[model samples]
Target chain A: MGEGLRGSIETTGLTMIYRSGKVEVPAIREINLTVGPGEFVAIMGPSGCGKSTLLHLLGGLVRPTRGQVLIDGIDIAKLSDAERTAVRREKVGYIFQRFNLLPNISARANIELAKRIHGNGHANLYKDDHILALLGIKEKIGFRPTELSGGEQQRVAIARAVINQPSILLADEPTGNLDSHNSRLVLTLLQDLNQRLGQTIVMITHDSEAASMANHVIEMRDGRILARTHHFVYEPEFEGLF
Target chain B: MTHSLVAANILSRPTRTLISILAVGTGVILMLIIGGITTGTLNDYLNRTMSVGADFILQPSGSTVFYAFSSAALPIKLADKLRETPGVGAVAPVLAKFSSADFGLVFGIDLATYDQFPGRLEILEGRNSLQGNEVIVDDLYAMSHKVSPGMTVEILGRKFTISAICRRGSVVRVFVPLPTLQQMNGTEDKVTIMFIKAAPGADVESVFRELHRAYPGLALVRTTDPSVLLADTRMPGLKEFRLTVVTVSMLISFMVILLAMYTTIFERTREIGILKSMGASKAFIVGLILRESVIISLLGIAFGVGASLIIRKLITTAFPTLQVDMTFVEVLRGSLLGLLGGTLGALYPAYKAARMDPVQALSYE
Candidate 1:
């Protein structure tokens, strides 16, 4: 259980292929990638370039057809499904494009559910309050997801993801559903937590502005990594692909 | 956290939840009311028979205890022979027939022979005589039919005046003269059953044993213990009836919950995916589904018990002859079976939810 918080990811020869009715379709193929501890990386690609597949593989949501995904020297690709779930539970948090907040429960309950899944029980209600405050959503904690704006629901999802203090946070188009204002607020919060809390984040987005906020940007095309860039100004090159 | 999540899930869809609850509740009601009536009727028959103050009741071998179903009649001369047995004090011969008009039995008993027992028919109103076209009715029958003394009621297509109204809880609610009923039925020398009483200081067990030896061809059933009366295997289809009621009740609970929870899981596919993505284990997902079912079952059980009690009271009040035994034990038993059915029903749905692929589930619309 002591899988500590120094999040370093290294993937060697990673590949994923879907097979259906005698036809083989490759989603991600032979992609070697690495991100240092505490770094914020963003992946940008057009549709079918395997950006989402890579993120799913990284978060252990889907098993790779071939390769090794080493998170802090532990290979999740070789682990059993249950063992991988434990690794995911212990180290990775996901922010989906749709928020995925349970609509039947309140924002506070959605956050507490992560703690419950993390096995912290009632011991961390005070800690959850602090996380809600950090995200500037303490007031809307009692409201259900149906009552919240897209931005607020994503914020609750973020609070849920990070409440367990995971080593890696995976964001799949975190600002995809929000307006310009909400997009800016969520991006700012992500960057704030990445820098101050030393949280490792890998985000996939079509927005160059959102990708520009990360410390590193990796561009993908045809199911492979095409280029990498450090924190730079938004270039028009990243905007037209998606 | 599990219970709260389950509660919130159920409360979110008020219409669906209520339908499930009501379906389960309806199952409970069927089990309680139908089963209660059957047992109640049998118990009432046994109690009234025992209350006749008879040590034993003699009937033909293999004759059904429910007199309506038993057409075999003992020869009236057998009563005289039974009276000659040592320690036998009195023997009352009764000729019984079921009247479709009242949906009950009409007993014809000799006044002198019936009055030999402690629960004799007390003449509450008109003359005690059962001479020529006279009838006796219980208070319940009198009140229900609105018949008073001297009112002529056609029984078996023959007109008879209500000569007396006796107390209720007797073997039969309606009574007629033995000789007249025998004459009309064309069975003057035959009787359905005989209530036998032992003389004072008589050893009743020995008397019954001796009578059993003498009347080896007949069912000399001892009525001293009420259990023996019910245990007599001649009562038609009682065991099968109870079993069918229980099985049908459980099937109702099982099928309703199975369908409700199965549909629920499919509707909440994306929520299940979200849970799985949040690192919820298989047991956690299963626990969530089963917890919701348990809550629904509990609500259904509560509704069922409350409804059953009200129904029992209504039935007993409106139809005084219907003895509905809604005992605490019966209620508890019905509740537990309903819960078991619900839990079992939810298992397949829970398993399906637990085994869902998170990637595919999250992709569900």
Candidate 2:
């Protein structure tokens, strides 16, 4: 496999509806969007705008009523559940808003879990140390989720998510529970990962300030894309500067 | 993940683990106790029934009825003919009576020939042979009746001296000379049974066949055979009662195991879901749960067997003559039975846990 090669994501006529009793509420309606390889995209909208629903649909976490989600030229919607899980394991990295680390395991074990799940043989050989050093959490490897600060825990979560080195990283308000200082730190890490590693990042956030950190921004309202913005890319001069 | 981790996971919840172990332990203990009692009592009954020193029992043809109530009589001449046959060592005629009034048995034996049989009697007091107007009562009966070696006792309105007190077959017995018994009962010519012994290397089957051929009306039986030992023996109702008791105990053990396994699965619903989400196949999840259950069951079985053995030892010590033998094979059999019962009990819960979906499991509060 080629290192630091990003994968593109595309959705066509994606429609999703939530049904409870006799009521049918549309979450995402006939939406079409595309993100190029190595592109950092952000979805921004108000509450109940189906931003998370669209992200879930694109990630194959939820089945769309009628649509196609293509990742790296293959329509993931056509894959079986087991096959979809395999694709997610091999190609997609998910960072949940809640930082869903298994509470019983230590920080290093949490990161090791991802590698083990992907059948990586070298999971135990300095991989935890490397990820922790990259995230500046080398000392917190032995700590469990309860013992870490919000920022440190989210960093551990991010390390766990990216341990497999997936082609696409999906973040659902990764900084929702952090302070501004931690939020900036997490956002800068995401941006740095996308630039240096060329890992495609698709983030969903309600805050415009958070969305401004991305290279592209898409606005959604009532299950539809209200607007899209493409920002100018600024290539940093120094490489390996950390 | 790893075997060590799986073991740690199973043992992490101390309370749940202990409860599961206790469930298995309880079942094993109950099985051990019931099995011990059944084997102990059955053996005791057999020893007692065979206590008449009868190496070979001769009854009527096809007269394998196992209750003492069967009054089937064998011809007295069969004993004389068996003594005349080749390889014949000794023979004795016995007249067995079941008296509801005394709630015991009275055997009319010839003291002259009873000495040839092993474990014939342990005379506790007084003379060995039954003299004129005298009888030998069992030690238990003598103790219960406060009768000593020379005391005169009345039986069925006939007075006789207690010539000796003896113990045989774990029961309260009384022995009178055949002539006196026949004179008192007015059955001088009839004989209820015959006990025979053969010389070393004599084929018992051939002798049995010859005896049957000689006296076609007499049914030759071996004391060791389960069918023959049970024939014309009292306590069929007691055997049936013991069987019912054992069956009910097993059913209770099964139910206990089922309930415990079901609760264990129910409590681990979220953990199962997590494993499934971690790419664990349904079979893997099921295997893990089953491993956990079997571990708990085996632990319980071990504890139960130990406890039952202790109890059995205590009982045996408390009553020296009451034999309690629990072989290793019996314990192994009991443990395997427990394992099978535990696995059967856990099948439904294992299936339920395996069928759980990851998304739904993670969503559970």
Candidate 3:
């Protein structure tokens, strides 16, 4: 897609280490990865494998202890905290495993809040009705997150994420809290969004079925990439995958 | 949408919101009511004193604005000496006594000498005679106590028949003959103060200066100006008392808002994380929290101002002799102080919320 050219992401030797007192623990270490514009990439890994930390770094949610995170050719790791926040506001949208909808406000308010954070400078490519209808949450936007089912809440969260038409979408197990049927619904919706909007998508998931929807899948272990594949495969070497 | 979020946050926990609002409102009320009473009593006393059209007042050295606080140290013979001074036309000797039962001062004055001033007591009912054991009550005092002409009232522990009801704007609500109050007080030749009036076409400033020169050992006060009369130096402990009341009132608002907003931010830790994850800046987060507090403060101010008005009405209705003034300026000052306290209280919590880590916050249970 021609729009994908502006959403490319690349990282060089990215690292994140969390410290408590004098004890330093590396969450992610020496990670080199790249995704072309509009690429739907899924990261598959076991728990504590730094999949979420990598996603957080990509979204500018945390400052990396070392290395470079390039979004649209601009390195965010070197930017100041405020500057990084501006970049995140203008170019990235995040979806959490729990949906992360502000529970006190209506779904519509949640979506509107993102637009407010993005500001009024950008010329939006899609209207609210088109996005809401595409995500099939136009009728559910009046309810608070607690009142909606898990799948409905995820749909609302997707609408909130894309309402500003950001260039990058980062999902930390977007369907982790959904049932099997809702999981398929959310995955198909993410696939549709990536394809229709030409937005680069980076998602972390344990379910292989969720990974199959992405154009590229990267498997991670101990904060390092163990395999990169174009299609989902239950390989023999990756046994005992609990 | 931001406003709705703030409103929803405040409305979600109705009980806590109500308690916070009430606390802030109570602070404003305390400020307005106590402050109103202090100012009202002071102004009322000073204004009534000035109403007598006296150019100057002579009292014992180091006397306060409250004449009741001063003993009868100025001799009644000082009236003749003051009257003989240059530019002094009339000198009225007044013996003032504090009446605990009335919560005011009782004044003893000679009817003939007091009438020489411009603000003479004009009789509205009964006879214009104040003699032995006969009291003259102002219209306000009469109405408040349901007393009228021919009614016997116990004043200063002595029975007195109401000889007349004067107009409301008098120097004191209760008045007795100068000789009678002096005899009862056991200070037959002593007086509390002397109200001196300048002759017609006489310069008041010259009279004031002459009085000051003539009574070098006594305190000479100009009675024409209210501000000069109510100066802090003349009213000992008045400024400090007002400041103490204001400080206590503001502390209530500050503490309530600090605890409320502090608890609120902790409860909304996850929501703050969500905002940060949505790319909200520190300023945006702080703005959200401040906006909520300002709204709460505004609501509390409105509640406070309304309640203060009602309380003022109740106080005056119950105690007609007492005055509590809640002027527009006082109301505005109270509102602004309450707002300031609340805004200050929210600062720490807002800072904490703004500095929250999105990663840790998102993962928080």
- Chain B TM-score, all predictions listed: 0.97, 0.73, 0.97
- Candidate 2 lDDT, B307-355, residue by residue in tens: 8888888876665444565778778877877777677766777888777
**Cα distance off (Å), candidate 3, residue B50:** 1.7
Error of 1 at B23 (Å): 1.1
Query: How would you order the candidates by lDDT, starting with the best?
Result: 3, 1, 2
What interface-residue Cα RMSD does candidate 3 give after superposition? 0.7
The DockQ assigned to candidate 3 is 0.80
Give lDDT tens digits, candidate 2, residues A132-202.
Answer: 67788889978878899999989988887777777888898998999989988998898888887678889
Judged by lDDT against the true structure, how good is candidate 1? 0.87
lDDT by residue (A1-242, candidate 3, tens digit) is 24445788999999999999999999999999999889999999899999999999999988999999999988999998888899899889898899989998999889988888778423354588899999888899999999999999999999999888889999999989999899999999999999999899999998778888899999999899988999676454554463
Which structure among the candidates has the greatest lDDT?
Answer: 3
TM (chain A), candidate 2: 0.90
Instruction: Give the poorly placed runs of model 1, Cα more than 4 Å off.
Output: A1-6, A236-238
Tens-place lDDT digits, model 3, residues B194-310: 999999899988888877876789988889878878887789999999899888888888888889999999899899989988889999999988888888888898999999999
C-alpha displacement of A23 in model 1, angstroms?
Answer: 1.7
Report the lDDT of model 1 for residue B139.
90
Reference interface contacts recovered per candidate: 0.56, 0.04, 0.76
Off by over 4 Å in 3: A1-5, A121-126, A233-242
Model 2, position B365: C-alpha lDDT score: 61
Which residue pairs come into collision in candidate 2?
A: B48-B169, B59-B219, B65-B232, B66-B232, B66-B233, B67-B233, B67-B234, B68-B233, B68-B234
